[model samples]
Target chain A: MPPDMPTEPIRRRIALTDDGPILVHGPIEVVLTDGKTMISDRAVTALCTCLRSSRYPICDTSHRRRVRNVTARGSGSGMDRGGRGC
Target chain B: MLSSTSPRPVTAPALPAPRGPLSSAVLAALRGISAAPHAAEIPPGAVGQADPYGEDLQLALYCCYELHYRGFAGVSDDLEWDPGLLGLRRQLEQVFLAALGADVAGGTDVAAEIGALLVEPVDAAGVSHHLRHAGQLWQLREYVVQRSLYHLKEADPQAWVIPRLSGPAKVALVSVEHDEYGSGNPDRMHARLFADMMTELGLCAEYGAYLDAAQATALAEVNFMSLCGLHRRLRGGLIGQLVTAELTSSPASDRLVRAMRRLGCGPRAIEFYAEHIEADAVHEQLIRHGVIAPLLAAEPELARDVVFGIQASTLLADRFADLLLSRWAQGRTTLRNPLPELSHRR
Candidate 1:
């Protein structure tokens, strides 16, 4: 394959995302354990190391915390973040 | 609407219908019906009298800002810099800003504001959530029509802040905007993708076609972007608007995707929101660390304005959602002119 063909070494900028996807700046091809390969052409491709994203290998913000604090709530004083009033 | 490259004149859509005196005068000026822009009775000393978010003021301000993006057909390009129009625009902006100033209390806590946006409220039932669960197909169609006004010109508004920014913020903003403009491929541009989605959904995809139907809140949302962009002093507000959009879009977009899927929408229609699902995830990161962080570091004084920007965007968006949900609850059309119900859709 032309991609596998000999070429000069190219530098890659990689950032480790805490409990999230690994940010790699460049076009990348990932070979999965089941022999399936996925290719991304984004300027920066987020490879999901946590494997939590619905769109595998791509961070869908599924890594963000979603704690259900039952005790932290009072008599639901008023509507919070999203607009959900009747 | 413009396909301009370097060293080229641009083209945009024609004028939309005027709701009241404010829009009527501006539209008349654009049509050359009044060569004496100064003579035109367009909110002359009446800016303060107009309701800040009413149909008249919002639509009038929207027309003025449209001159910067895509001037109406047959309108003079030189009109964009007309002093009279700028004077009127300043008046309208002051009225709106005064209202916003009174409404959203100003602060310098950018971190807390963004943190609130990051958390997904479990009790949320915004438009996307409603559409995902119980919204009818016709309601979905209406939502797209209203949204088309902004989506057709996706990244164009924020693009104005480019020259105003410096260092890492500018670089990062441009990088995210690069993706919005379709990463050097006009075919993949978010605007183009949105247009395709509109076509797939059997709606008019042409620029500004839905202007007549868009409500005051919808127009106000776009006007907020233009208001911030045209002024160098309001760059912080523009970034704040951007941060709100990038941070909130991912989850809302995911719900939209689910809505489309539940409604059995075509792949092309789904692609637009699906693209947002992944793209905005990355964009949120870029805005937080790349744009917001660097911008605050470079210019610490902009924090209050940034908060203003965030609150303004949220206020306008909530108002829009309120209009949609309330109207839908009553089984009425949110748009001024209701779309014809297609037999196939029903």
Candidate 2:
């Protein structure tokens, strides 16, 4: 597989199992875990911010990538210095 | 719709149908059929529906303001400077601003206000909240469709303040703007991303396609940006609007990204929100520490205006959110035309 192509053609779909916000935008033909596939022409879009994704931005993969870079980098810091990444 | 990069000038859409006497006269001027404003034939302020967010007033104000953004498709560009139109715009703005001023309580502590904005309500219910939960792909698409109005012209309203700002404050605001404009890559420009999302959703990628379908609630929100952006006097308010947008965007963008994935959207759809989640997180800090703090430090007297800007933006945003949720709760399409019908159009 090319570097850009998924190693295993990871299945992905954008779905809302519950009332959560999750939207994804990229190449078309991505499939979700719930068996739904979003086929499109133009590329790029906004996905739901909510964590409950089935194929996220495409069905129901339910993937959650918390921007833990903030928490991970700033653990145990109070609000005053929270943004400083202590 | 005009892109500075393109030689082919971006023309505005045609004036919409008149909803009432106010809109009728305003639309006439936009169409070049009238030479003057209806100063003598003012709609008795009392006659207007009491809703400050009324469709007729907002639509009237929106058409007047659109002249500044993208003038009507066939309308002469010079109409952008017509005194008649300007007069009418002032009348509408006076009424609209007065209502907003009354609704949003004034405050002196700018930093405290910024602190409060950073704190999202635990029980917040918005389109993002809806999408994060059981929001359908169609519903998610619908939300983007409405947002296209502002995002399509992202950063333009604030750009008006470039000349109005100076020193570190001006420098800071432009730095953030440069990113919003794709940091030298047009493809990465936020508006382009928004347009990309619209096309991906199978909606028309043309600018202003949704203007007709957009209600007063949505139109007014953007108009407020223009109101602040265009007036040099309102530069403080412009920053307030920018600060408010940047401050809240991080968390909202996070929720939106998740909403997309849950609905099985593609990467193209995800990129716009993904960019915001990270970009705005930084922007939140930059706006607070970089832009607002330094700006106020330079022009201490502008503090009151800054507060006004924040309060007014919140007032407009709350109204916009309420309209969308209420319409959705009623099981009706929030757009003037239903999304289901839109998909079938193509």
Candidate 3:
């Protein structure tokens, strides 16, 4: 075990593993097979917050829609003000 | 919890200690080699009894009903179809459903009933209200554990009516079901989300873990689900139950979400309620405008049963709420026994 290894890795059975960055959320610590390690906040996605692009889990056009939605809802409001569905 | 391929299909834990003679007979029959032939014998005045919420009778009926859901751990799953047990279950149902029929006044207007359901109770002194205010995490966990009996396989009880329904009603119900089933995304399934919350809260995620400890009120509530679900004739009742649930769920769910966050629970623990806050709000509208509207529009006769379903479900819910709140008022745990003494921090 590496000295800096995460003590508690987020555990979920892999349902699908494609050629894409795996998104981990909520108190996660990832340990790659080659001993690389990473820790994350509760909401972090793999290199992309916007759910866009053909290569999902990676940013594409989806991020733009998300950015606008965030703005429409007002940044940092935490409440989706846009009444898309009531 | 066993996977499909597993050789050992998980069984329900053994019947809890019997509450009365009715439960005793029911449990004995469930555990015995051959069911006692007197399965049809009704406790004197079982039907007309003023307090139809008798723990003994209710628990017995619940046990008989549980066979249809998850059979007890040591009990044979085949008992689910045992004729004697079925006969017993039917008798119990007749008594219980008859009581509900008599008590819940028949409503010719289903729309009025559905509309009435959408109206949230003000100053509703229930678990959700408690949770939204001073409810501690342990209390919330206990409540969820009690709720596990239902949420673990939500939408299943109502699923019985899918085939019974046609046209718009069926499509709308299925639409709601699709979401409940996670829209082909297993990770997003509501039941899965609930289990995740259980795990996050350090409760046993195994289905039915607390069956032995769940009081008769809790058991009766889920048993009502099974009663309405399993009977083809009770499809309207089931839909009524479903409507009541979806309609009332959103605000309660919002309160639960706030409760989880106030207690400083993490995202996984809060996600179940958070998801329901939106999902059930949409489901409420769908059930009202989509399902019930078309359903009663087609078969207007079902309105009576629909009323029965709503009233029966509400009665059971009130009983459950009383059990919990009364227990809490006495500074006691609502479970049959308090969970193993683990001091829950925060």
Give TM per candidate: 0.90, 0.76, 0.74
DockQ (C-alpha based) per candidate is 0.20, 0.03, 0.02
On the 0 to 100 scale, the lDDT of residue A18 in model 3 is 29
lDDT of 3 by residue, A46-80 (tens): 33334433333332212221222222210112121
Candidate ranking under DockQ, highest first, comes to 1, 2, 3
Q: How much lDDT does each candidate structure score?
A: 0.80, 0.67, 0.66
Please write out the lDDT profile of model 3 over residues B105-185, one tens digit for every residue: 566666666545444444346777787788887788778888887777777777777888999999978878887876656
Total backbone collisions for each predicted model: 0, 94, 6
lDDT of 1 at B170: 96
By lDDT: ranked, best first: 1, 2, 3
Q: What is the Å distance of residue B226 in model 3 from its true position?
A: 1.2
Q: What share of the true interface contacts does candidate 3 keep?
A: 0.00
Q: Better model by lDDT, 1 or 3?
A: 1
Pairwise DockQ winner, candidates 1 and 3: 1
- Models ranked on TM-score: 1, 2, 3
- Cα deviation at B333, candidate 2, in Å, is 0.6
